[model samples]
Structures are given as C-alpha cells and as structure tokens.
Target: MPSYAVTGSSRGLGLGFVQALAADPSNTVFALVRSISSAPKLQEFVAGHAHKNVHILQADNVDVASIKTAAKEVGRITGGTLDVLIANGALMHHERNKLMLDEFPDESVLDDDMLTFYKTNVLGTIHMINAFIPLLRAGSTKKCIIIGSAIGSHKLARRTEFTDNPGYAMSKAALNIAAVRYASKYRSEGVIFLTITPGFVRTLQGTPEEVEKFFSEAEAKIREKFPSYEGSITVEQSVRDQLALISSVTIDRSGDFVNRDGKNVEG
Candidate 1:
C-alpha cells in the first residue's frame, strides 16, 4: 500500500490532496492538521464518505514536538514506512500580499513578519523532514514533496517583476534550497526531495464578495506579470496534476522546483 502523510490537511490544497489520496481505498492517507476541531471539513468528509483509509492526526507545523509525535504515530500505523511526506503547511497572509520589502510600517514589523514566515515555511518543514526521514527511508516510494511557489523563483520574479510579499517569497526560496540540500544528502538512499508549485490555485475561502474582490486583485497582479495568463485552477485540479507529477518524477529530478506541468518553475 502507498502510505502518505500530508501536513496542513485541514483545508485548501492540503485538504484537496487528502481527498484525492483517500479516494483510493488501497492507499493509506494520513491527514495531519493543527487539530481535529480545526478540521471540520476534513472530518466531515471522512465521516460522510466513510473513508476508512484516512487517518487524521494533530500536527502543528510550528511545533516540532507535535510533528515528531505525529511521525511516530504514522510509523506505528504504517509498519515503520511512509511512501510520501507532503509538507504543505505555510503562512501566507493575504493582507501582506501587496507589501514590498521596504514598504513595511517599520523595521521591527518587517522583522517580525519575516521571522514568522521563516519559522513556519522553512524551519518547520526542515524539522518535519528530520522527524519522518527514518520512515521514508524504509518505504517503497521515498518522496518528500514541499509545496513551493512561483514567487520564490528568482528567475520568475525577475522576469515578471512581481516584487511583493517579500517575506513569503523569501521563506519559500529558503524552503526550495532546503529541499535541494535534503535531496543531495538522501540521494544515495534513494529518497527524492522535490519542491513543486501547485500553480495559481484558487483556495481562498471567505464571503462571496470578499472572495470576488480577492480574485479581482489577484488577477490584476497576474496580468501585470503574464499578459496572456488565465485565471487560477481549482484545488482539486491542482492536486490531481501535482500527484501525477509526483508519481512520475524520479531521483534524477529530485531537487527540482517545478509547476503542475512538471516544468521547472525557475524557467
């Protein structure tokens, strides 16, 4: 059985991944959320669909101990092996979407925001990998996938002149580097560490007007970057494409940062 663990599986792209993976009864799916109460949607889906293969575990990304504990539970359940570890937990403050590096109110505020992003997006993911490495090493498909963003790609940023949300972008870039380092270290052990963007996924949840306004602003920004760009994809489509890419990718392409199409995002 292909056993997988997805962090931040309470909602959005993470929830979509859980739904897709759990659909296959043969696949053992672990949905790691901050708490069961916080994941009503996931709980509802599991209960409604009667997906016996889906396991929900509390795992806050900022808490290394929580992640380690969740890993232990997964190891126990999966016989000390895990096929995939999907690190999807991240901090993306929509309010800060338009804030440039120097546009912050003050240096202190900027530092606080950047540090918060770093703690979750970079350090937390590193700790998660550390906690799950043993189980992954013993698994059949040892793939560690980090959900990255195009904003993190220096080449994409330069090409599109999309310079905003510096903290989020910087943290994601650091995460990409972390994945590459892990790939290098674990290549000999046949563990593939990859960073992939889910594309422009429309995972926003809010009032209808709020959602509309958010997408309008986002589309404007996207148009500024790519004139011919279309709208965002559904979370389901994005997860499907990503899972397909994950299944086909080999160790040779391990350290790559790619999009849903399996093309390098840096290009």
Candidate 2:
C-alpha cells in the first residue's frame, strides 16, 4: 500500500485532500493535525470508514519538537518510506491587520503576528520535508507537494490584479522558490516537487458566508481599482483538481508553478 503524509489535515482543504486520499483503497493516509480530540469531523470520518489506513497524528507546526516526534512515529509506521508528502498548512494574518504595514512596516514582519505565519507557512513546512526526506527517498515515486497561492506569482502581480496581502503572498512566493530549488537539487533521484495554487477555495478557515460579507464591504472598491476580478471556487472543486494534478506529476514536470487547471502559472 502507498503511504501518504499530509499537514493541516484537521480541517479545510487539507481535510478534503485527506478524505479523497483515504477513499482510495490502496492508500494509507497519515494526517498531521494540531489536535485529534478537537477535530470532530476528522475523527468522525476516520471512525465511520472502519479502516485503519487513516492515521491521525498530533502536530503543532510551530513546535519543532512535536513535529520531530511525529515524524519518528510515521517513519516507524511506513518503515522509512513515504510515497507522498504535502505542506498544506497556511494562515492569513494580514487580513486582520491591513493597517499593520502603515502602522509598523519595519517592525511588522519581525513581530509575533508575521513570525507566526512564517513559522507555520515557511519554516514548519521546511521541517516537515527535511525530517521526511529519508522516508521519501526510500519510496518508488517520491513527490513533495507544496501548497501555494496565485497571489504569490510575480508574473501575476506584474500583469494581473490577483491579491494584495503582502505578508501571505510574499511567504508563498518564497516557498515556491524554495520548492523549485529543492526539486532542482533532487531531480536526479526521481523526486518531484510541485508548487501548486489550489485557487480561492471556501473552506473552514473562512466560510463562504464570511467571504461574502467581506466582499460586500470591500468588493466594490477592489473591483473599481482592478476591473478583472475572477471569483472564488468551491473547496471540493479545487481539491479534486489539485489531486488530479498531483496524480499526474513526474520528474520532468518538477519545479513548475502549476494551478488547478493543469496549466503553467507564472511566478
């Protein structure tokens, strides 16, 4: 059976990916969540499935010691061979403090707020891959999937009106570069690193209702400034598309900025 590891599987798009992967009879999914008891949906899904393939491991991304311990546990389970690994945890701290830049540009990035995002989005992801590198190397088709966003695309920023969150966008952009670099270094070992943007998905992190409310307040101003605003997609649709793309990944396709639509996204 193919063994898979995914971060942030407690909820949102991560949970969607876990569910889809678990549906496959030949796959065993190791979901790294913050807390098992708090995640009723995840617990329910795993329980109702009546299969032991779905393993939920507690993981606080910011806690390096916790991640290391969990990695060791997973290493034992898979015998140091993991087929798939996903860096899917993310945060949008900038949304709450739009004036943060104006108030504290110099101190903002270094503050606890932005540092938390980096710890989870960037550093934590690095730790996950590094600790699991040995396991991935032992697998047949070693693939590392890094969840990114269209907002991080430098090309999109230059041409289109995609996103305005500098902290979140910049972090993802940096992640893309790191992913590409990792892919280039390991391409010879049949390791595929795919940087993907799952699209604007409505997930547990932010409900569609909340997004609607936000849009109602800020949408007109955004639309007035940038005349081309493509709306969001459902979480299910985005997850399906992302899973399809991940399924088709190969060494030749590594280090590419890919979107849910199977086309090359610029960055």
Candidate 3:
C-alpha cells in the first residue's frame, strides 16, 4: 500500500488531496491537522473513513515540536516509511492589510505581515523538511511535494501579476528556493521534491451577479495574459490534475516548479 501524509488537510486544497488520494482504498492517508476541535469536518471524515485507511494526526506546520511528534506517530504506524508528503499549509490570509511597498499607506502593517509570511510559509516549511526527512528516506517513492503559487515566479511577476499580494508572493518565492535547496541535498537519495502550482483554481463561490462581475474582470485579465487559457478550473479538477503531475514526476524532474497542467513555471 502507498502511504501518504498531508498537512493542512482540514480544508480547501489540502482536504481535496486527502479525499482524492484516499478514494483508491490502497492508499493509507495521514491527515495532519492542527487540532481535532479546530477541524470538525476532518474529524468526521476520519471517523467515517477509518475503514478507508484515513488517519488524522494533529500537527501544525508552524509548530515544529507538534510536527515532530505527529511524524513519530505516523512513522510508527507506517513502520518508518512514507511514500508522499504534501506540505500544503500556508499563511495566505485574506484579511491582512495589503501592501504595495512603494505606495503602501502604512509601514507597520507591512513589517508585521512580512514576518508572518516568512515565518509560516518559509521557515515553517523548512522545519517540515527536517521533520519528515527520516520518513521520506524510508519510503518508496520518497516524493516531497510542496503546494506553491504561480505568484512565486519572478518571471510571472514581470509578465503577469495580481494586485496587492506582495506578502504571499514574496513568501512563496522564498519557499521555492528553500524547496529547491532541500531537493538538491536529497536528490542522491532519490527524494523528489516538487513545488506545484494548482493554476488559477476557483475556490471562492459567489452569487450570480457577484460572480459575473468578478469573473468578467478576472477572466478578461487571464485571457489577455494567456490567450490559450480557459480561465480558472474547479478545485476537484485542479486536485486531480495535480495528483497526476505528482505521480508522473521523476528524479530527473525533482526540484522543478510547475503548474497543475504540467507546464514548467519561469525560474
């Protein structure tokens, strides 16, 4: 059986990955969440999917000790091996004050937000690399997959970019480098570290009128940027596509950054 562990599996893309991977029944999934109380849906899913080999582990991506402890538990259960680990947890909060750097109205907000992004997305993810190294070393495929954003690409910033997402973009860029460094270090051991972008996924649903207005503006920009693009894909489609990409990746392509469609992003 293929053993998989995913962080931030309580919601969004993380939850989708868990659902898709566990559907095969041959995959033993460890869904690492922060806490059971904070993950009611995940808790319920675990209870219902125990027969499906879905186990929920409590761990926070930002909390190193928690991750180490969870990893130990999973290592014992899986007998010291893990096939795939999806580091999907991040700090892309929508409520943070937007900073444009040059035209930002406030400086303190930028300072605080930058630290938050670096700590969670960059440093915290680095900690995961350390905590899970043993399990990856013992696993079969030894794939360490990171959920990165298209905004992380410096070339994408020059070609096409979103407004007011500096923190998210900056942190993601840092994470890309961190992932590449780890992949370089472990490549001789056959560990495949891939940073994959899910490509413009429509995660937020809205009313008819509201949706029309938003998509009209967003889709127009997307079409203007990539003429061949068909706009945002559904979360289910994105997850399915990403999983395919993950399975197909080889040691030769390790440390690469690509979109959900299997295209390489600019370095």
Candidate 4:
C-alpha cells in the first residue's frame, strides 16, 4: 500500500484529501489534525469507516513539538517510510493580507498578520519537510508536495487586479523559494519537492458572511474576468483534480509550481 500523510486534515481541502485517500482501501492514510477529538466531522468519519487504513493523528501546524511527535508516530506506523507527505496546513489572514501597498492596514495589524502568516504558512511547511525527511528518504516514492497559491508567483503578480493580497502573496512567494531550495538540496537523493495551487476551492462553507458576501462577490468577479468561468469548484473537486495533477509530478518537475489544471503558474 502507498502510505500518505496529509497535514491539516481536519477541514476544508485538507479534509477532502483525507476523505478521498481513505476511500481507497489500497492507500494507507494518515490524517494529521490539530484537534482530532474536537473535530466532529473527522470524528464521525473515523467512527463511520470500517477501513483500517485511515488513521487520524493530532498535530498543530504552529506547534513544532507536536509536529515532531506526530512525525515520529507516523514514521513508526509506516515503518519509517512514506510515499507522499502533503504539507497542506496554512494560515490566511484574508482581509489584512488582501490590502494593496498604498492601502496597507494599520502598522500593528500588518505586522501581526505578516508574522503569523509566515510562521504558519512558510515555517510550518519547512517544519513538516524537516520532520519528515528521514521517513521520506526511506520511502519508495520520496515525494514531498507543498501546497501553494498562484497569487504567489511574480509573473502572476504583474496583473494587479488579481494580485491584491500582497502580504499573503509575499509569504507564498517565499515558500516557493524555500521549496526550490529544498528540491535542489535533496534532488540527488530522489526527493521531489513540488508545489501545487488548488485554484479557488470555496474555502468558506456555511458561514453567513461567506455565503452572503464573499462567494457571491468572488463568483461575480470570476464570471466577469473569465467568460467560461464557473465560479469556484467544491473542495472535493479541487482535491480530486489536484490529486491527478500530483500523480504526474516527477523528480524532474520538482520545485515547479502548477495549478489544479496542471498548468505551471509561473508562465
């Protein structure tokens, strides 16, 4: 069985990945969660499934010690080998991050947002990669996939209308750089460091603000910009499409950033 470990498996796109992976009994899935006991949907899933391959382990992205412990447990469970480690956990301070340079928020808010975004989005990814390197080295596939955003690319940023989230974009850009560095450092050992953007996955589900305002505004803009646009896909579809794209990545493609449709973001 191919062993898979996905961080932030408690909700949204991460939860979708866990569900899709666990549905296949051929895959041994590790659902790394921040609070497995408190995550009702995850708890329901674990209770409902009769499959032995889906295992949930607790780990907070911002908590290095917890991630280390979780990594050790995964290593032990998978016998020190993992086929894929999806570094999917990240923080998004949307409103503050979406502000333009001249429209920057208050100094305190900007500082705090940038700091927390980097800590969780960038450093947390590095932490996952570092903690899992040994297990990856022992694995057959040795693939380390870091989830990223198209907004992160400098080429994409040239279109100011869509690149409004300067802070979040900057953080993701740094992450892309880090992923390339890691790929360069580990390529000889057969480790593939890849970054994939999931496009827009409709992250907010039932929140009133999201339903009434956020998604509607986003959908309107998408239709206006792209004539063929169909708003945002469900998280399930995004996960499904991304999994297909990820399966095609090879060591040669390591550190290259691509979107859900398998197109490179940099271009």
Candidate 5:
C-alpha cells in the first residue's frame, strides 16, 4: 500500500489531499492537524465516508514535539514506512494581503510578523522533515513535497512587480532552498524533495465580502502579470493536478520549484 502523510490536513488544500488520497483503499492516508476537535469538516468526512485507510493524527507544525509524536504514531501504524510526506501547513496572513514591507506601522511589528512567518513556514517544515525522515527512508517511494508559492519566486516578483506579503514570500523562498538542500543531501539515497506551487486556489476562508474582495484584487494582479491567466480554481482541481504531478515526479526532477503543472518557476 502507498502510505501518505499530509500536514495541515484540517482544511483547504490539505483536507482536499486527504480526501483524494483516502478515496483509494490501497493508499494509507494520515491526516495531521493541530487539533482533532478543531477540524470538524475532516472529522465529518471521516465519520461520513468511513474510510478505513484514513488516519487522523494531531500534529501542529509549530510544535516539534507534537510532530515527532505524530511521526512515531505513524511509524507504529505503517511499520516504520512512509511513502510521501506533504508539508502543507503554513502561516498565511490574509489580512495583510496588500500590505508592503515599509507600510508597516513600525519595525517591531514587521519583525514580529517576519519571525512568525519564518517560525511556521521555514523552521516548522525543517523540523517536520527531520522528524519523519526515518519513516520515509523505510518506505518504497521516498518523496517529500513542500507546497510552495509563486509569490516566492524572484522572477515572478520581478515580472509582476508584486511587492506585497514580503514576509510570507521570503519564507517560501527560503523553504524552496531548504527543500533543495534536503534533496541534494539525500540524492544518493533516492529520496525526492520538491517544492510545488498550487497556483491561485480559491480556498474561501473569510467572510463572503472579504473573499470576494481578496479574489478580485488577487485576480487583477495575476492578470496583470500573465494576461492569459485564468481565474482561481477550486481546491479539488488544484489537489487533483498536484497529485498527478506528485505521482509523475522522479528523483531526477527533485529539488525543483515548480507549478502544479510541473513547470519550473524561475528563481
């Protein structure tokens, strides 16, 4: 059986991954979230679908101990083997969507935001990989995937002149390099590490008005960059495309930062 563990599986793209992966009875799916009770949708899906292959485990990306504990639990269940580790948990400050770096009220505020972003987006991912690598090593297809952002690409930023969300973008850029470092170190072992962007996915997290406004603004910027770019896609389609890309990726393509279509995003 193909064993897959996804972090931040409470909702959004993470939940979509769990749902899709669990649809196949041959795949063992581990859904790691910060709190079991907090994920009502995930709980409902598991209870409603009764997917025997799905396992929900508590794991906060910011908490190293929790991740390690969850990894141990997965090891116990999967016999110390994990085929894929999807590092999808991240801190996305939607409220600060259009805010520029210099637009912050003060340096202290900027520092706090940057530090928080780094803690979750960069450090947390590193800790997660460190914790679950043992199980991954024992598995058949050793693939480590990081859900990255196009905003993190220097080339994209230059082309679009997208100067907002500096902290989040910087963290993702760092995450891409971190994935490459891991891929380089583990290349001889046939472990694959990749950072793939999910593209503009309509997660619909905020209020109706807020969601509308955010998408409108985001779409405008995206179109400005790529005139032929279509609107945002549903979580389902995004996850589907991402899964196909994941299945097709080989060790030779490891360490690449690419879009959902597996096209490289120039740094």
Candidate 6:
C-alpha cells in the first residue's frame, strides 16, 4: 500500500482529503490533526473505517519540536517512505476582525497574529516539506503539495480582481516562493513540488461578513457561467481534483500555481 501524510486533517479540505484517500484500497492515510478529541467527525471517520491503513497523528504546525517528534514517529511507522505529502495547515487573522484595515490597524495586534501566521503557514510548511523529503524520495511517485490561495498570486493582485485577508495573502505568497525554490533545489531528486489554489469554499477560517462576501461573489460567477449554480460542492470534490493534479504532477509542470479546476492562474 502507498502511504500519504496530510497536515490539518481534522476538518474542511484536510478531512476531505483523508476520507477520499481512505476510500482507495491502495492507500494508507496518516492524518495529522491538531487535537484528536476536538475532531469528533474525524474520530468517527477513523472508527467507521474497517481498513487498518488509517492512522490519526497529533501535531502542532506552529511548534517545530512537536513536528519533529511527530515526523520521527510517522517515519518509524511508515518505514521511512511517504508517497504523498500535503502541507495543508494555515490561518488568517483578518477573518476574526470586525474592523476594516483602517479601524482594525490596532485590532489586528499585528506582532502576535503576523508571527503566528508566519510560523504556521510559512515556517510550518517548510518544516513539513524538509522533514518528509527523505521519505518522498523513496516513494514511487514523489510529490509535495501546498494548498495556496488566489489572493497570494502576485499577478492576480496586480489585476485588481482579487482580495483576501492580508496575513493569509502574504503568507501563501511566501509559501509559493518557498515551493518554487525547493523545486529548483530538488530537481535532481525527482521531488516535484506544486502549489494549488482551491478556489472559494466554505471553511472554518473566515468571519460571517468575509464568508458572505467571498462566496456570494463566487456563486454569482458560477451562476453566470453555469446558470444552474445552486452552489453545491462537497469538500471531497475540491480535494479529489487537487489531489489528482498533484499525483500526476512533474518537474516540467511543477511550480505552477494552478486552481482546483487545473487551470494555471495568471501569475
């Protein structure tokens, strides 16, 4: 069986990835969740599955020491080979702010929130990629997937059609840069690195206003294109599409920021 590790596996896109992978008979999923008890749905998922390939791992993306320990444990369990790795943990402080940038300048508490965002979204991604590169090298198909956002696309930002949480936008942009550099450095190692923007989806990271504004506009676009846009999409739909892209990715196509639908975003 092939082994895959996904961070932030307790909910949303991460949870969907774990479930989709588990449905495949040839895969073993090592799900890294922040708290085992806090995720009742995920725990129930593990319980409902009859397969012995599912493993729930406790991890903290903001803590290097915790990641090191989890990596060591997973290494021993998987015998030092991970077929696929997904850097899926991230945070957006602006989602919690009711004040706009003007009133929220101080509401953000920038020093603390920015540091947290960098630690979890930026540094954590780097740590996860570095820790598993050795194992990915041993797998049949080597891939490192980073889940990014369109707001982070420099080109998109320049187009005036994009908007997002300042912290998340900047952090994901940093993540893309890191992934590009890593892909270049590991070209000879055959470890393909790819970043994907999953498009707008209902997730746990945003406020009511932010969510309403984002999805309302996105839904409008979908309605414009498809006409039957009842706004229906399972989390699995997004995960499966991105995972398919990641699984088939190569150095020739790596380092390209594509959307969930597999179109290269202009960047």
Q: Write the per-residue lDDT of candidate 1 for residues 1-267, one digit (tens) a residue.
A: 999999999999999999999999899999999878989999998887765999899888799899999999999999899999999988887577678988988999888888989998899889889999999999999999999999899998788787778889999999999999999999999999989999888888889898889888888878987898867888999999999999999999989999889998876
Q: Candidate 4: worst 10 consecutive residues by lDDT?
A: 156-165
TM-score of 1: 0.96
Candidate 6 — which residues are off by over 4 angstroms? Answer: 93-108, 161-164, 205-214, 217-232
> How much does candidate 2 score in TM-score?
0.88
TM-score of 3: 0.91
Considering lDDT, where higher is better, how would the candidates rank from best to worst? Answer: 5, 1, 3, 4, 2, 6
Q: Model 6 — TM-score against the truth?
A: 0.86
1-267: candidate 4 lDDT, tens digit per residue:
899999988888888898898898999999898777757787788779878688888888789999999989998888888899999977764656557756665778778877877888898889989999899999998999999987788875664357466777878999999999999999999899989998777777567775768777877875666667666778889998989977877898887888888788887
Model 2 superposed RMSD (Cα) = 2.7
Cα deviation of 200, candidate 6, in Å: 1.3
Pairwise lDDT winner, candidates 1 and 2:
1
What are the candidates' C-alpha RMSDs? 1.2, 2.7, 2.1, 2.0, 1.2, 3.5
Which tens-of-lDDT digit does each residue in 134-238 have in candidate 3?
A: 999999999999999988899988887666678889999999998899889999999999999987766554687876776678788877888887787777998
- Weakest 10 consecutive residues of candidate 6 by summed lDDT: 95-104
Task: List, residue by residue over 164-206, the lDDT tens digit for candidate 2.
Answer: 4666777788888889899989998988999888976666346
lDDT of each: 0.91, 0.80, 0.84, 0.84, 0.92, 0.78
What overall lDDT, based on C-alpha atoms, would model 6 receive against the true structure?
A: 0.78
lDDT value for model 2: 0.80
